[model samples]
Target: MPSSTQVQLVRRPRGWPTEEDFRTVSVELGDLAPGQVRVRNEFLSVDPYMRGRMNDGPSYAPPYALGETMTGAAVGRVEESTSDELPVGALVLHGLGWRDVTQADASAFRRVEEIPGGPSSLHLGLFGMPGLTAYAGLTAVAGLREGERVFVSGAAGAVGTAAGQIARLLGARTVIGSAGSAEKVALLTSRYGYDVALNYKEAPIREQLRAAAPEGIDVFFDNVGGDHLEAALDVLNPNGRAAVCGSISAYNDSAPKPGPDNLSRIVTRTLTLRGFLVGQHPDLADEYREAVTRWFAAGELAYDETVVDGVENAVTAFLSMLRGGNTGKMVVRV
Candidate 1:
C-alpha cells in the first residue's frame, strides 16, 4: 500500500472559498491492480474554472463531489506501473490533481515527453490547457486574421498571457490587454508581446480601451466578463469577433449581477461573440502543441508561473488564483 496526501472538498462555498471548505488528509492506497499505475505528482494546476465546479451548478464540467479527493490537471512521473504502455519513469498528464500522489489505471494517464530541464509544471500551464484555450479561441472561434487588432482581458493571467503572445504571433497588427495592476500591465508589454497594456484599476476599463485603440478593436479575447465584456463591446469594430472564455469577475458573486450594459453593441457593430470551452476544440490540440512547442523552443514565447509550494497549500493557491493573486498560471509544487 502507498500513502498519499490529498485535499478534499468539505463543503460548497457560498462565495469565496475558505480553508474550512477543504480538508487535507493522508490516505493509504491499495496495490495497483493489473494495468494500473501509481504516480508521484510534481505539480498540480489551480485554474479559474475549478471555482465553478466547487458549487453545485450547471457547467461544462461536473461539480466537485462533497467528500471526494478534488481533481484537476496534474503532471507527474510514473513511479510504479503494471502496464507496459506507461513504464516506470515515464512522464504523464492526468486529471487526478489535488494530491501529491495519484494512482489509477494506465488508461487514465497520457504519457508526455520531457523537454530537457523544463519544469514538469509546464504541462499544467502555458504548454497545456491555458495555451490551447488561447490558440483555439483566437484561431477557431474568433477567426483572428492577419493584421487584425486584438484585445484580451485579464491579460496577465495564464490564458491572457498566452493569448497576447499567440495573437501577435498570428500577425495581429496590434495587441492590447487589460490587467489588474500597473506591474502586470508593464509585464504584458515587456514580455508578452502586447503593444498596449491598460491598468484597469487606474481608470475605467471602457475609457482606457477607447483611448488606447481610438479606431476600434477587431478581435476580443474575453476572460473577465462584467465591465471588461462591456468595454470590449463598446470598442469593437463592425464585423468584430470575440471569444468568451470566462467570467471570473462574477465567479464569487453571491447572486448573478446584471450583464454587460452594452450588449446591444453586438447588433450595432455586427459583432460575433462566441462562448467556448477548450475541450470543445480538441481537434486543435496537435496543432497548438506543435506551434507552441516550436515557439517556446525558439524563445518566441515567454510566460510566468506563480508556484505555491506544498500540496497542503493547494487551497490557498486556488483561492489566491481566483482573487487575481497569480500573475500567470497558479500551480502547487508538491
Candidate 2:
C-alpha cells in the first residue's frame, strides 16, 4: 500500500477562500481494483471556476463537498496500473486536484503525449482546457468570420491570449484586447499581434473600447462581465456576436453588480450573446486540438503560463489570477 498527500476542503468559503478552508492530509491508498491506476501528480490547475466550486451552491459543476478532496485538473505519471488502457509510467492528465497522488479509474485519465522532455505545467494550460475553450468559443460559438473586428476582455489571461491569436489566424481585420495593466496591454498588442490594446484599469473602458473598435465590434469575447460587457454591448455592430466566457469581475463579488444597461442592444441590433462551458462542447475538442496544434507548430499561435510552485501556494495562484496578476494561464506545479 502507498500513501498520498491530498488537500481536502475543510469549509465552504463565503467570499475568497483561504488556507483555513483547506486541509492538507495524508491518505492511505488501498489495492487498486480492476480498471484502476495510481498516479503521482506532477502539476495541478488553479482556475477561476474552482472558486465557484468552493461555495455551497448549485453551479455548472457540483460544489466540492466539505471534507472531500479539493478537485481540479492535474497532470500526473501513472505509477501503477491494473488496466489495459493505462500503463505504468505513462504521463496523463485528468481532473485530479491538489494532491501529490491519486488513484482513479483508467477511464477518468487520458494519456498526455507529444511533450518533449515530458509535459510541464503548461500542458494543463495552453494545450489543454483553457486553450480549447478559447478556440472553440471563438469559432464555434462566436462565428468569428474573416475581416471582422474582434474585442476581448481579460485579453492577457489564458483564454484571452489564445482567443486573440486565434481571431488573428481566422482573418479578423482588427483585434483589440483590454487588460489590467499597461504591461499586459503591451503584451497583447506587441507580442500577441492585437491591433489595439487598452489598460482597462487606467482609463475608461467604454471610451477606450470606442477608440479601439471605431468601426464597431463584430465579435466580443467577454471574460470580465460587469463594465467590460457593458462597454462591449454599447459598441456592437448590427448582427454582431458575443461569446460569454468567464466573468471574473463579478466572480468574487458579494453582491450582484449592475450589468450592461444596454442589453436592449442585443435585441435592437439583432446581436447574439451565447454563454459556454468547455465541457458542454466536447464536439469541438478534436477540431480545436488539430487547429491549435498546427498553429503552434507553424509559430502562428503562442501561449503564456504563470506557475506557482507547490500545492501550498495553489491558493495564492488562484487569487492572483482573479486579480489579473498573471499574463496567461495560471498553473501550479506540485
Per-candidate TM equals 0.99, 0.96
lDDT of candidate 1 at residue 220, scale 0 to 100: 97
- Number of backbone clashes in candidate 2: 0
Q: Compared with the true structure, what per-residue lDDT tens digits does model 2 show for residues 1-334?
A: 7988888888877766677878878889899999999998888888889889888888899988889888899998899999999899888989888888899799999897765333556678778888889888898889999999999998999889989998999999999999988789889988887999999888889988987777899999988888899999989999999999988887777887776799999899999999988988899888977787777777787777787888777777777887878988888888
In candidate 1, position 100 carries an lDDT of: 96
Q: Write the per-residue lDDT of candidate 1 for residues 1-334, one digit (tens) a residue.
A: 6899999999999988899999999999999999999999999999999999999988789999998999999999999999989999999999999999999999999999886446888888888999999999999999999999999999999999999999999999999999998889899999999999999999999899999998899999999999999998988999999999999999999988988888888898899999999999999999999998999999999889999999999999999999899998999999
Number of the top lDDT candidate: 1
Give, for candidate 2, the lowest lDDT window spanning 10 residues: 114-123
lDDT, candidates in the order shown = 0.94, 0.86
- Distance from true position, residue 67, model 2, in Å? 1.4
Q: Total clashing residue pairs per candidate?
A: 0, 0
Q: What residue pairs are clashing in model 2?
A: none
